[model samples]
Target: MRILLASPRGFCAGVNMAIDCLDECVKRFGPNIYVYHEIVHNRYVVDRFTRIGVKFVDHPDDVPVGSILLYSAHGVSPEIRKAARERKLQTIDATCPLVTKVHLEAIKYARDGYNIILIGHEGHDEVIGTMGEAPESITLVETPEDVDQLPFGPDAKLAYLTQTTLSVEEAATVIRRLEERYPGIEHPAKEDICYATTNRQDAIKALIGQVDLLLVLGSQNSSNSRRLQEIGVTTGKAAYLIDGKAELRPEWFEGVNSVLVTAGASAPEVVVEEVLEHLRQTYGATVEDAITREEHVTFPLPKELRVLQAAGA
Candidate 1:
């Protein structure tokens, strides 16, 4: 077997920043720190953190009144922050700056009296937090069909923003629909989809033609990971989304001689190594790097941690 490994596959800068923030908080606060959600959407990452005594909670009420609480990379609603404030919980927001950018745009559009359209999946943590910024003004739509059902006419003062992790093609279709319906609808000053998402998807698209099968390492609920898998499926190749080496089945590789391997932004490189090793041992696979682009972006650690470090507290 031959393995075409994708570059820029795992742990985007935002995920790295969020995970590091949680790690620093745990080191400082000794597992008394409660994360508002899975720090990232990877099962292995969350399980590893949980094993170290860090508590993950669905609500702020689950945490002690004065304990530290960290928001996940996906972000949270303003109401969640309000609840945390009411409880006097020390909070660290690990929201990806890209996601925060979308939130800010929503607030600005709402303040200007525009009906905002958010193109994203319902119930996604990122989408939920973004809509919460201006729930009165934001409307969530999943597909082009949903856009057609919108009550707005062409002349309405409308603006559109997107969840940071949506599939590029999917977002474009919805965007096209929105543009057709409301020609004057405003767009973000920049693309809301982060650079990492676009780069990773472009890497996969480049490698699809060279491989017979595709393996994307990520958890089921991970939005970016799911988008990678969808790319393979739509391209008519056999693709599977696995958490790690354990989920690999021998039969899936029966007729597959060449495979493309990649991981979601939340997935760890160690897991990617394990998968490659398994394939090597089982099929005598040879691995080659599929480099499309290089990523040099980095985000600073959360401000609360920075202040503490500056104060030596």
Candidate 2:
């Protein structure tokens, strides 16, 4: 059986930076560090960190004062940053530069008196953090239907930003609807959806016609991973989101001669290898990694970590 692979899949710059920050922190601090959230949104990454004594907390109070606190890669609201400061925690912001760009846009528009409409799933960490930038000025819209329900006037000096991990097609429809309703609505100077999400989706879209089955390696709650699965199923191919090789169902391959493989942003490469190895052993499948896009994105380590590492601490 032939295997089609999606390029630009798994471990974006933000996820990589966050995970690397944790690894360095653990090595430097000796495994007693506190993280404000799941450093990134994957269960495997979090579970592995937890095994090594990285504590994940949901509130500032959960972490002791003067302790080193690393914010998740999804970024945190300004209010959360204020609270962390109030508690005197040493803050290490591991927010992805892409997510930070949207937060800055929200802040800028809010300051300029624009009624901001943010396109994203409301409860997602990135959405929550971006909305927190200007909660009073921002409204969350998940679909075109949500866009239609917006109560703003056409001349209200509107602006829109999106969560970095949204499905490109879905976000486009929402953007189009906003344009139709508020002819003067402004878009960010640069697209808010990160290059990784766009490239990964494009890669998967390129492979849809060749594969009978698509396996997405990611946690169930991972937004980008879910989007990949939807993209496959939406194209009339069978697709499933699985955490790793163990979750692969033999039933999915029953009539499938060719399969496409891809992974979510936070999913580890080892999971991909394990899945590919399973496919090879079970179905005698030959493997090939497709190159759809070449990515060179890299985020620098948090300032605190940099200083500590430089000091030989």
Best by TM-score: 1
The sequence of per-residue lDDT tens digits that candidate 1 reaches over residues 94-187 is: 9999888999999999999999999999999999899999999999999999999999887999999998888999999999989988999998
* Candidate-wise lDDT, in order: 0.94, 0.90
Clashes of 2: 0
Per-residue lDDT tens digits for candidate 2, residues 198-311, read 988999999889889889999998999999999998998889999998887777888889999999998999999999888888899998889998999999998878887788
TM-score of 1: 0.99
Clash list (residue pairs), candidate 1: none
Candidate 1 global CA lDDT score: 0.94
Query: RMSD, each candidate, Å?
Result: 0.6, 1.0
Tell how far residue 88 is off in model 1, in angstroms: 0.5
